[model samples]
Target: MIRNKKEYKQYLKRDRLALEIYNDGIINKLKNLFFPNPIWTFQKRMRKLEYYTNCKNYGLYKLYIYYLKYRYRKISIKLNFSIPINVFGPGLSIVHYGTIVINFTSRVGANCRMHACVNIGASGGEVQGPQLGDNVYIAPGAKIYGNISIPNNTAIGANAVVNKSFSEENTIIAGIPAKVIGKVDIKKIIKYV
Candidate 1:
């Protein structure tokens, strides 16, 4: 359903759905609120759905949701060239969509928001991948390759290419090979609408 308001509210009526959404929001917000970086509002929105869903165990939830996400992502990648996906909880949200190829070893923190045409994979068969922190925001058309660690609350600008690890907070990164454009405020982003 791509996570519209009506769908979220309807889904939240269930006990488990409601609980899960809250936890998701809490986890995502932690990085946004405390971490020294900016996060994506879309991710926060996904978390609210988790809270509304009332998910209990993260492990089981991750497995179930990830499987579904992987399926959806694969299909969307093949057809639409656009992934209007709503990824909740954990695990599967990291599922690659379109030409977005995520390496098997890539570890993503809670509440990351990714868009279509993103490629997060290994560099030169290194086998190692990115270790992304909570509430990271990657705009469309970004490519993050190699064994990199993107710290909490960082925002990668649209069409940016990231090849190295970055830990500084509130940075707005952009360009081919992604340079720090500036810093961003996660709270301000979360407060968005």
Candidate 2:
């Protein structure tokens, strides 16, 4: 979550790096203007919403906050994402624009790279959702729920169902009920982080 201008700019820089958008020159700006990336636009709007929400809610700022919220919601719906504000830390990489649902209660650490069709929510009517550590990689179609804590530098395989916590770090978890399959160097997986 962006509380101030510094944090907001840092988050935007990290997000851009995670999305592999290096250059911000005139040519790049023209390209983006001509062919807009919905994912990038959505992330920008989400960051702005977070920043403004943390600010003093009065006068024109309040109205602008409402407008940002509306635009964020619209973009989220168009991209099939149900992510809430402040759920993810800096350097969040959404690999693809697909059905990605994250519970509002869930908290993900910095540099989380997630693929399409990923669901991170609470199970059994619980208010708490999964808390993932930094540099975590969630593959496509992975379902992670409940009050679970996934350690740092962990990678979840595709279509894996994770309901329990894993204590070990730098490992890959896969299959139904999700078990540690092999060790992984998270630096290799998440390049920008």
Candidate 3:
């Protein structure tokens, strides 16, 4: 949880990176306020409020958190993402927001992009669910489950159901119980961080 102003700043940095926007400095951060993505904005606000509520004991912050929760809940309902804030790493981008759901126990790495109607969850036997890697992209209507480990810089095609893990990286996976259908150009999709 974010503890204070410093942690809040760090959280904002992560949020900006997750959104794939320029956040090199305060100027860029301020400029982003004018041109915000609705879905990301909703998620960002919710996460900040959640951190504040947990990190502080002051009455004012608690009240503020309560107010933000009310507003964030409305947007979350409209967007249809029932995600837990702590599950995702920095650079979690929700490209489209309709019907996206993630299990609370699942772990998503940095710079992961998810399209609409994607589900990453558990499949009965495993309570831990899927563990996704950094810079992964999940297309719309994709269902990823079980105790699987998806490698870095991979793309899961639309409507694909992934039940097992892939050991390799930079691959494009598709179909029912997804397999490596193609290869992704790693240089084109990611920057060395």
Candidate 4:
């Protein structure tokens, strides 16, 4: 959801911080160019694609956008990810490269750190998906579906099946049908938010 150059830059900075890559020097750039992390490369291309897609006067850069799309798709397939563009806000940290499927209609807030084997989608044929709030941490093997809304600073435990909406924030939800298990300090989980 990058609307302008400033917001795009801000998103990139937050993304880098979320990925824990602080340095942006020439040496670092050259190193990344030669030996890039697959996830980082994919995220970088994803951000570029999002920015250009939201830009208005990019007549000369359509080919570049297509190229970015191709690369994004290729890497996503390789990494076993089914995420769509603009679904995640700034500061998105994919902790591991594994099977992570998210519905295109789902909206995740900023500072979300998700692990592997996470599925966020609709229950059946529904088009709408879960809307997660900011500073949420989704653990590994979490299955969140339906048209639910998760509050801010919430933590979903591993292997939890969330189908209903929780009314509170800053809580941990984990169970077969996902209930508030305990309170959570989001700052301890997500460091870069």
Query: Who wins the TM-score comparison?
Result: 2
lDDT of 4 by residue, 1-193 (tens): 8899898888888988898864679998887778877777778888888998888437878888888889999999999999999999999999999999999989999999999999999989888999999999999999999999999999999999999998799899999989999998999999986
**Residue 6, model 2, lDDT:** 93
lDDT of 1 by residue, 92-189 (tens): 23222345545657776545566667877779969887778766777778898898888877888888989988879878888987888898985454
What ordering of candidates by lDDT runs from best to worst? Answer: 2, 4, 3, 1
Error of 1 at 190 (Å): 4.7
Candidate 3 clashing pairs, residues 3+ apart or interchain: 18-91
What's the TM for model 2? Answer: 0.96
Could you tell me every candidate's TM-score relative to the true structure?
0.54, 0.96, 0.79, 0.93
Model 1, C-alpha of 51: deviation from truth (Å): 17
Local accuracy by lDDT, each model: 0.57, 0.93, 0.79, 0.91
What would the per-residue lDDT of candidate 2 be over residues 1-193, giving only the tens digit for each residue?
6778999999998998898875679998888888877899999998888888886467889999889999999999999999999988999999899999999999999999999999999999799999999999999999999999999999999999999999999999999989999999999999986
Sort by TM-score, best first: 2, 4, 3, 1
Q: Model 1's lDDT to the true fold? A: 0.57
Name the TM-score of candidate 4. Answer: 0.93
Candidate 3 lDDT, tens digit per residue, 4-95? Answer: 67767776677666666775688877877777677767767766875777676487777877787778777888778787656776666677
Residue 75: error of model 1 in Å?
Answer: 4.5
Lowest summed lDDT across 10 adjacent residues in model 2 is found at 50-59
Instruction: Kindly report which residue stretches of model 1 are placed more than 4 angstroms away from their true locations once superposed.
Output: 1-99, 190-193
How many pairs of residues collide in each model? 23, 0, 1, 0
